[model samples]
Target chain A: MDPDPTIAAIARWSGIAPPNEAARIGLADNAALITEIEAMRGTMGFEEEPSDFKAALRDCREPTP
Target chain B: MNAPVAVTDLASLSMTEAADAFATGEVAATALVEACLARIDAHDAVVNSVIRLDREAALEAAAAADAARAAGRPLGKLAGVPMMHKDMYYRAGRVSSCGSKIRRDFIPGVTATVLERLDAAGAIDMGTLNMAEFAQNPTGHNAHFGHCHNPWDPAYCTGGSSSGSGAGVAARFFYAALGSDTGGSIRLPATLCGVTGLKGTQTRVSRAGVMPLSFSCDNVGPLVRTARDAARFMAVTAGHDPRDPTSAREPVPDYEAALTGDIRGLRIAVCETFFLDGADAPVVAAFEAALDALRARGAVVTRISASSMRAINAYTAMVSRVEGAAIHANWMREHPGDYAIHLSARLFGGYAFPAHLYVEALSRRGPLLRQFVAEALTGHDIVATPTLKTRVPTLAETDIDADPANWSRFMAVSANTRPFNYLGLPTISIPCGFDDRGLPIGLQLAGRPFAEATVLKAADAFQRETGWHCKAPAL
Candidate 1:
């Protein structure tokens, strides 16, 4: 995970040429959030839809407003 | 019955009170508008809350409302009430800067459906309020519009991206302001500025023409002086809008009618774990006192463990960050320099999220939400917590761009409030007490999905028993 092209490289490919220093630090700081995302792996059941609309609206007592 | 309002009391009259006075012929709409404008003129320089002040137009609208009343023509529920919204809500042909330099001159061809509803209810649009650039930050620091200072004490942060909305309402600049929340924008600001804010169930209000940061989590609501004001505002603004396909088709209940102020048998759940972890002494003290007040009102409060909250908070950020990054991808490519450095840096992280991870996070949202509701809200009518875990920080202390060390402090501003955005539950923040530094503290009450009436009922009951919501900044 440490050896691949950095977030900076991926961003450059996506055409967002932010300052190199800020980009590196920003991506590094985001590692924590990514780790949290990684923890969610294998947690979802296939029947569970990903959309918040589906989740939020499910079993909501009100008929859709 | 609403109390009779005098012209002199217009400056501090709650939204519902002002509206009632306008309807009863006790005060003219012109007088209320003038009182609000006078307050803005006197105190706005320090608060820096308003982005624009539509003086002539507001007066013209108020005069029309008065003319309608004089002629005994039909009037909307909010006849003659004045309000401003976060700069993001679009009004056709009007410049909605959205608190960003890139959109400073960009005008939309269509109006936000919420604005049309407010207009139909006879709310006078005073102007736009300041916010975090692109509604990205939790702290109300806007690099584009000067940082909106807290009305209580200008040195402290007002908590944002709805900074101006909270501060404007606290300063009594206007009765209330519309604020959109993705990651605690409305509640954070409301708590910090000592006002009331509500984020209804996701898609509970139409998002059409309002700026979007995270498509999944964005919620449009209000920051006002009292919960009843929020109730009236919600009743007018909420409902299915065909213009926004995602808008809930559920019927919009009379939120005001639910505020009967008798919470004798209400059940409040207190997750005493993640929400209170590392909370400051003053915050905990205020929260405990608020709980005691509720118990005195006959609410049965129960403490329980919500160990899943840590995970809930973690994934909430992931979803918003990914969506925000996607929304600004094109602009980041074209006009990257136009964004504030810190905001750009935050958005830059969004680009790094893998599509698979984003989908995983999104997919898990449903299961995780069910887990939370089942665990936290089974027999509970409302879950209460401090809106923010710490005392309000100074603007300088939370300026992440100025010093990256401030990142933790800046992030904590929304820690307790963001989970509801993910859960998509109806939630509200109301002033309960003040901290050591005298900044206001908020008691957040989150209800079940689409249970806004229950949320407002609890909040309005609290207001009836306490005078916190009536307190305003000396400024």
Candidate 2:
């Protein structure tokens, strides 16, 4: 039988060697990470700006008593 | 004036206390270095926390410090204090393996900005401490270097990728050690080892010349024996660094001076949703005790809800995974076997993330932070949680490569910590109590962005009311 297509596609696209069975199992378990990412897909508006590298400093000066 | 304390007693002094002794000329710097070296020699065999010990150079530096003090020259706040750092921080003409075989002999010409800051503050660099490979893992099981055993108990984990920082501090081998937190590395080890760790608001400290894990989440901080020590360490190391453009340019506060021990009207919110979900019973008991301690110090504690945190915690990994994979793209392609199996597995999945998803994760950071702040911290000064939802696991339990079935246990170590990294807020972890197994549990206090002073002040107040931070591991 052929290898799992999901694993094969990941191997081919990444150009890294195919992970061994243990590694493959761990990778397969990242479904929750993917699900979270998918849920936030369009939650952001275009008007909303991404965080800047200097955002920390800006937020620091955000005026708190 | 009284006579100088003995070198044997130096191990018992906190970093702030030791530095004060140094400033008063009560003890020679040479004695401090020798005492720490002796402790490392006697205890490090079991802890496996140190990667390198620059004995000769450290002693020489100590002598120089003594001479400078005798000459009546100005001294740095950390003058004569001995410390080792996580192996990932690069120093010129020194080996920084970063707990990875691939970089065994890698030496960078420039020292990390944080190292330069510590050097300027008169801190002695004894050597490098152990960490997870590429600062990747949270439970401190480095396949390249032997796992860092907890000083409290050799069988349990030291918590990583700042494993050595935690263990070495608990062992009293050094006053403080720098631990980088991408997702709870510093805080986890601090909690597990019964020390204190502070992860300032993201970019509060420069990351120039340090190893990168996730560009967005990486933070530089210290794991020390007391919140006061962490406060002083942050004051010295925080602020803008031209060397690191991402470093915040905010004026550094006198973190040590901020510890007034009065937290009157300090409102701390406890979210009963995601943070406390499935938390271990013992951990819950310890966290409530910590709240009581804080309340005794005039801090108002209330329960609140931040429903968005569940999604926040879940999405935190995507940013780090994608960025870490990109950082190691070349190495992953060429020397895949050089990495530990579990680390390789985690990085492998990073390659599977879609570009838009990576961008989405990054772009949504601001909105999510705003949402979380509005939900959790609108009427509160800080949010409190258990640093780890569960007790510290054994090295055997978290060694995923040894048995992949342990993945959930391994992943759980950072569940409470990762969300703060995502929110880019200043957070701290301090020992609260021990679990049924006698492993240390940590209380986490997170503040509004760049409100590190508030975080440290509250922590110091709690420390004043409780002796948990004063309890040393029976190494």
lDDT string, candidate 1, B349-387, tens digits = 777776765776677677677778878888788999999
Worst 10 contiguous positions by lDDT, candidate 1 chain A: A44-53
Q: Candidate 1, residue B320: CA error in Å? A: 0.8
Docking class of 1: acceptable
Per candidate, native contacts kept equal 0.38, 0.35
TM-score of each model, in listed order: 0.96, 0.96
Docking tier of model 2: it is acceptable
